[model samples]
Target: MNRVTAWLPDRIDRRVRVVAWLSFLAQTIIIATGGAVRLTGSGLGCPTWPLCTEGSLVTTPEMGIHGMIEFGNRLMTGVVGIVAVLVVLSIWRIRRERRDLWTLAVVVVLGIVAQAIVGGITVWTGLNPFIVGFHYVASLVLVCVTAAYLVRLDAVPGPRELAVPSWYAGLTHATTAVLAVSIVFGVLTTASGPHSGDADAGRTGYNAELLEHVHAWPGYALFVLTLVLLVGASRLRLPVRRWVVVLLLVEVVQIAVGLYQARNGLPPLAVGVHMVLAALTAATMTVLVLKLKRPTATAAPAGDAAVAASAR
Candidate 1:
């Protein structure tokens, strides 16, 4: 065990950074592939949980393209699991010294397992819209955690202090709240729209049009707030400046795709892009939140993160 521990790096190295990035990238890829499964109407292509179908561990020739798409997404989960495991092992030696990285790695693994079960439930429940929405929210959360790990990877091992003004921090947090609200409403909007994973899966019995407008309200609010943040960040030269800019750009593309899909008969391709962008938006926001604080290098007390600016 000592030899094994010795083999692991005591600090973040290229390998550690690679694995950290892979963890986040894999999470994002899975979301995109999951979007493919839904947009392609293959949510039930497997037709059962823990198995592709009765007495078969994979999709059969008889299942056709839908099965392949759904099964492909499932296979991607295995890829995600493998990457997550690598993350845990890669940081095993440093777990004691870097509890934040260790904890986030464990969370990624647990989140993947939870996602698999929730995915099965989506199948069992006939793709219940609410459950599906929750599943999506759960995945976004995993993306956020992985993104946070990447941020914390470079943090100094000590307590943190807000680098921005108190009011700026409060506005930043409120923007995060608006972002969450936007996502919730967007999920609801999709739940009642034409795309519910499967044709026969039906919808959440709400007004799709109304929910679209409701979703846009928060989206617009988030955009305005982010604009304000970007202006302040540019002037203050805050650490979070670049990432808030990223968040704003993502929102722009997201809103564009959303509008295009809404007006263009809800094209599956556009919808899939929108979904992936949403995950990216959430991930970017996670980075922004982490940047609100800087490591107090000389603090008597310990903390979770370190100097993360260059790591991004």
Candidate 2:
């Protein structure tokens, strides 16, 4: 059997990689739609826990179109949950090569379920700022972990140890951490501060401008950090993969949209686009980091030297 086909189970014929890709795509859509719910001031449109107003999926006329929009986003979470299960099961059947991938998928599914419960609590408690903030943070974390899982699954056993500067790996780790923190700060701004013209109404706990400024500073720091990582990666002379380029472009677009939203008083459409781009950037970073091979700065054994010379 070929190397790619060797990863499959005898009982299952189709590629597990395809399922993994579909799960990633589904996850991206679900994250984007969830952001839409918050951006459009529909976070509380349902106005009840685990249901729309009055415990109906579609309540009375007073619930209106906004309520339906929110509920529909909620429904999309179920689709993500289904895809997560499929990914997990497909990997489990072929557990020999990629146990970690399946394990992370299992964790992601649990995280999403817990995230849904948190969403419910946010509504039940009248959209308490702290809980809502965590809800958004949780989604970002899920994307990060899920992306890492997907990338590792697709990884080939190339050379067992490709040579790259140790500092590049460190920078990648730092960049990923900063991006995650930036995402949390974003959630804080949206949850605690006024946004979408709802701040004055006391929907969230903090004032709009103050919370926004607090959130904005982290983004500036994160942008600089990402640049450092990117430059350092380029210096290593390791092959730059397609995903890294795509991720950097997405990050640039996300930053641009964020700046526009800030200047335009947080337009809903702009914020929604920013959220999707942020998720994509986060996912792509995960892929890039996973692809990186840290240099040990040690001489190779005779067997390894022979293979390396032959490949060159």
Candidate 3:
């Protein structure tokens, strides 16, 4: 079994881990629900900033189920945000000189704030496709950061310094590119797609057919690139290869969801799945890249079996 992280007190570490895991899960759910809000043409479900239909948190019954669903998502985001804060505080209390842990916790808090702002911008801009797309991307990035932090805490002990080879470094760069392109296409798909609420309420002025065309081509490209990355990773020996494999699988799953979304009218379930997969893909890639750095060990001279055996 993998050793438990030493970054927390024994009495509290289990609880902290649970909170961290739940925070990650909750973030995934929020991303998925956000996709549903877009797919169902319900972006304007609330119909007012910080309020649903010029009413309190709970308003008139006529606001309908969509309003409740979207608001529920927001509520969950708040819950996840609180968990993130608690995780940070617990880390600080348990570990001495855990600068990495502290840094990530701060990042988690910042991501929550950024997500909230982007959400407000989406609403304020009346669901402008560009800003809406950005909002979704931000959520994925935030999730990626949170997941990377978690993985670092869970990784096996190794040199404190990065010790990856140049080839692995190249793979990391390529994977990052793949991640960025996939996210862009995902955003494009969401921007051109329908929103929650009335059919015409949140429509973007861009030609839906043209946007679909744009989104589809990149989707194919991203899928291809992701496959290439997996193949390329096979040629390099890297500590993060397992995570890279996980990343590729996540991308493949996302590709399936994208295809399903295109065939069907962006069903709530499919969109939610797409959103979660996208975030997972991003998180996996982030962990892979963060593991990369110049090799700290000098390469052994060729045919030095005796020395190698001794070192081993």
TM-score of each: 0.94, 0.80, 0.79
| Pairs of colliding residues, candidate 1 | 155-305, 155-306, 155-307, 156-306, 156-307
lDDT (10s digit) by residue, model 3, range 1-312: 124345444333566678777777777778877877776666777777667666476545686777776776677778878988877866765344445666777888888988887887787777777887788788887787778767656433223455566665775676578568757865665666665334654545666656666666655665676666566656655566676677767767787887887789877677778778778877777777776643224322321332343244
Residue range 21-102, candidate 2, lDDT tens digits: 7777777777777777766677777878676766576645786766767888788888888888777767665555445665
Per-residue lDDT of model 1, residues 37-128, tens digit only: 88889999999988999989899999899999999999999999999999999888779878988999999999999999999999999899
- 227: Cα error in model 1, Å: 0.9
Q: Pick the candidate with the highest TM-score.
A: 1
Ten-residue stretch with the least lDDT total in model 1: 301-310
For candidate 3, the 10 contiguous residues with the lowest summed lDDT are 294-303
How many clashing pairs per prediction, in order? Answer: 5, 0, 7
Evaluate model 1: give its TM-score: 0.94
Q: Compare candidates 1 and 3 on TM-score and give the better one.
A: 1
Error of 1 at 229 (Å): 0.9
Cα lDDT, all candidates: 0.89, 0.69, 0.68
What C-alpha lDDT, on a 0 to 100 scale, does residue 237 get in candidate 3?
A: 52
Candidate 1 local distance difference test against the native: 0.89
